[model samples]
Target chain A: MSNKARVPAVDGWFTMDDEPKLLASRGVETGSYFFPKNLAFSRNPAAPTEALEECTLSRRGRVWSWTTNHYKPPAPYISTDEFVPYTVVAVELVDEQMVVLGPLATSCDPSELSIGAEVELVLGRLYEDEDNEYVVWQWKVVQ
Target chain B: MAVEGRSVSDVVVLGVGMHPWGKWGRNFVEYGVAAAHAALADANVDWRDVQLVCGADTMRNGYPGYVAGATFAQALGWQGAEVSSSYAACASGATALNAARAQILAGLCDVALVVGADTTPKGFLAPNAGDRPDDPDWLRFRLLGASNPTYWGMYARRRMEMFGATPADFARVKVKNARHGVSNPNARYRKLVTEAEVAASPMVSDPLRLLEICATSDGGAALIISSLEYAKAHGVTNPVRIAALSTVTPSYPNTLIDMPNFSTDSSFGVAAPERGFRDSIAHAAYEKSGIGPQDLDLAEVYDLSTALELDWYENIGLCKEGEAEQLLNSGETTIGGRIPVNPSGGLGSFGEAVPAQAIAQVCEIAWHLRGEAGDRQVEGAKVGLTVNQGLFGHGSCVILKK
Candidate 1:
């Protein structure tokens, strides 16, 4: 694992260093949060022109909903040579009261999931190339 | 309740028509032109007399397809008619309908023709072409491998956990819709399906079987709309008039996770609206039309999945939250039920033609209102409604009365 170079599928979404967290933007005045952070504009009607501040999201949340895919999705989604079904979880951030969606940890089983179950963020590989591993933030059941 | 301080003029649906839903493997233009001609004939109006044309655009066919209004006009032998095109995912037809109604209400056009058609590709739909990472539509699939059904599955599972809805309940929706489809001549799947058959079908997404989800197909639908005064002048008395049309967007701090968005807007700063986006859509229509859910004789809704049909019942105010399953189990939503829904078999039987299905829903309502629906007619139908939601958080509702 140490020999393989790691990178995010999309840059600036999360960090890989110690105490990793999902990166996001929050309204400085309105106290609202945005994921895949809106760099161009703020959507708050109360303060339409307020400046946005970058912040890392809460590390833990609860499962709002969950489902598993039995069929491979069509492109531009990358997949493996030997296809395997995967699960997606919609997690509600405890602090923000917002729902963020992501794939569950690859090793997690769908049968174990239930609504309101505690979950935490962890970086996992989505796919890989010859030299580097493509990764994205995923949700895992808190043990 | 007529949308306080706004005096809105009424618009009438002069005629409605459709090209049968199927996998015809033909040009979408052929379907659009054929449906337009049928609508014109149904209204007893000449094509040359139309003052405006509005088309629900399709994205699959490239440039000419995106410019659907002009393409359809040229194919129908153009007469210099004014044209407009609208694209709103599944709600495209309603968007086109709203556009035409706007023109008529504004006195810009006395008569307008609206058409929507599509020859959809088989299998799951892909995002629009290009390598723009910023597009959430692309990012969802690219990073999480989240297909459309994946989202539906999440909703189904959540409902099941919250409401004690079983898989059998979901299968029952297919059984009911398929039965309705058998009576619909224009339906793609005309054979009735059993609950056992639905359960046996392979799972595409957990909790949603292949038979329980709608398929994509090629189809077309068109409507001829005019001012209420024009209908009267044409000697058509008691024509079906459009009572209200609501096209609303999600309010700020939208809590529900909708399509094309990776995360929902945070409610931390402000309180979320009491009603979700779907409820607001129906509320707006009811407010504008001065009609309530009790007044509706029947309805047609977007049923992308069997579970979704149940969701619509609650969203459209046909029932209270978490009671849609009870409404279904009571046989209250069947064709002969107290408030019949999807008598045209819905997307379950007709499959999705994207741009065309919403118009087809209105077409079904028109036929029922005129007492022309042969086998699937609702007896003494006086008021009908259609509800549809498109990607990017567009919700549309239309109410029609005879």
Candidate 2:
């Protein structure tokens, strides 16, 4: 690997460790979970005033649904000179009982994946500059 | 518990009009003014006599689009009318219509006008140009490259896996809608499409081909409504009336994946809603108007993708879950079928004009109810419904009757 610093494309959204976990928020009173950490307020209307706490989501989950994106999405998505098609999957977290979306890992074969397949979160390169590599959480099919 | 019949809150639709859907590249104000004039003439109401103007907001346009009510009023020569502007993504038109309906029902205004128009960019609707990480609409694209079609593909894939819906089943929806749109004067594409043609189109998102998805278009639609008493006083009798207008938000713990969001509401703490968000939109209208699915003669549903139209078949209570494909194959949803849908050709033929779409749905339904839809008319149609949902939790269902 080249000598370059690895940084999150969007900070504080997920962990950078080998076993990356999505950072989320859970309502203290209602036990509801929110990905990307809903810091403003509890989204669960049943407990409108419940306090939220920082928590990590389940790393492994089943593929709830998936699609292969053939076209290069428009920006804020940082793109390279050449665009490569990628697979996107919505995974249902094992414990949170909610679905979260992300791209599939670069090494995985999208053709082999299907709904109800198990997958785990891992950090993958989104884009890169001369000095630093930008990374985001991606889903890797579990062998 | 369904309410029996027309309640005192019903508002009469005096007139409806629309600018033809296309990529005309004109200022949205031009389309809005044109549609407004047509509607005013149809209603036989002077512009100066309108008491309130409700405008559906379009974000793609400039500042004037945000204050659309005042903009349209000023474009129509500043009639000093009370104005309101509403924005709810794709549901903007329905939200604006609801605002006008509420004013008429509350006795605040005897006559009100609702208008929505948009001038869209050519390709996939991009988020407002910026590098903001906080916005979910941007984050979904930035983090996962999840364009709107990505969600449509996923939903189509789910139907394929769970309900055994095939690509051919999806293609049939396009063919059926194209056939209906052939006679529509205002539809951007007034032609027939075959299943083979749809199959030959390039795939944009996995199972969804480019032909199966709708494009963005420039168009406008407007409605003139009044209190029932106002219609009677104006020598108009038996006008088409809006029996129920449901603009309801999703209940908590929504599990279905929706647009512009990375995650669904967690059902860990609370039970999932009895009816999913999409199902509840029409359910509320049926409950309020006492017009069950069996009573609907025709429907104008949002068909952003062909497969989604099949999903709406179940969502609107036309068929049970996993039965939309069978419903389409049986030819039950076609023009002469049990319940004709998207008789205006839906977004499949017209493409989408964003803020103007929901109002256009109502406009199509009004035409059939008034026996003015010409060749595409559903004979002896007395009642119709329109359903559409926007990004976030904005969704509406409107039931109209003669």
lDDT of 2 by residue, A1-143 (tens): 96889999898899999899999999999889998887779988878888899999999999999999878888887777788888999999878999999899998989879889999999999988999999999999999
Q: Report the C-alpha lDDT of model 2 over B1-402, residue by residue, as the tens digit.
A: 112233445599999989999999999999999899989998999999998999999999999999889899999998789999999999999999999998777777888889999999889988988777899999988888889999999999999999999999999999999999998989999889999999999989999999999999999999999988788888998899999999999998889899999999889957788999999999999999988999999999989999999999999999999999999899888998889999999999999999899999999999999999999999989999999999989988899999
- Sum up the clashes in candidate 2: 0
List RMSD in Å for every model shown. Answer: 2.8, 3.0
Clashing pairs in 1: none
Which regions of candidate 2 are displaced past 4 Å?
A: B1-9
Candidate 1 CAPRI grade: high
Candidate 2 residue pairs that clash: none
Task: Give the per-residue Cα lDDT of candidate 1 at B384.
Answer: 98
Please give, for residues B1-402, the per-residue lDDT of candidate 1 as tens digits.
Answer: 112234336799998889999999899998898899999999888999998899999999887689999999999888999999999888889999999998788777788999999998888888987897989999999998888888888889988999999999999999999988898988999998999999999998888999988899999999999987778778888889999998888899788888878999999969889789988888899999899999999999889999999999999999999999999989989989999889999999999999898899999999999999989999999999999999898888999999
In order of appearance, the predictions have TM-scores of 0.97, 0.98
Whole-model Cα lDDT per candidate?
0.90, 0.92
Chain B, TM-score, each prediction? 0.97, 0.97
**Which candidate achieves the best DockQ against the true structure?**
1
Give the alpha carbon lDDT tens digit for every residue of A7-122 in model 1: 88898899887556889998889989999877667888998898998888998999999888888898898888877989999999978989999999977787778899998899
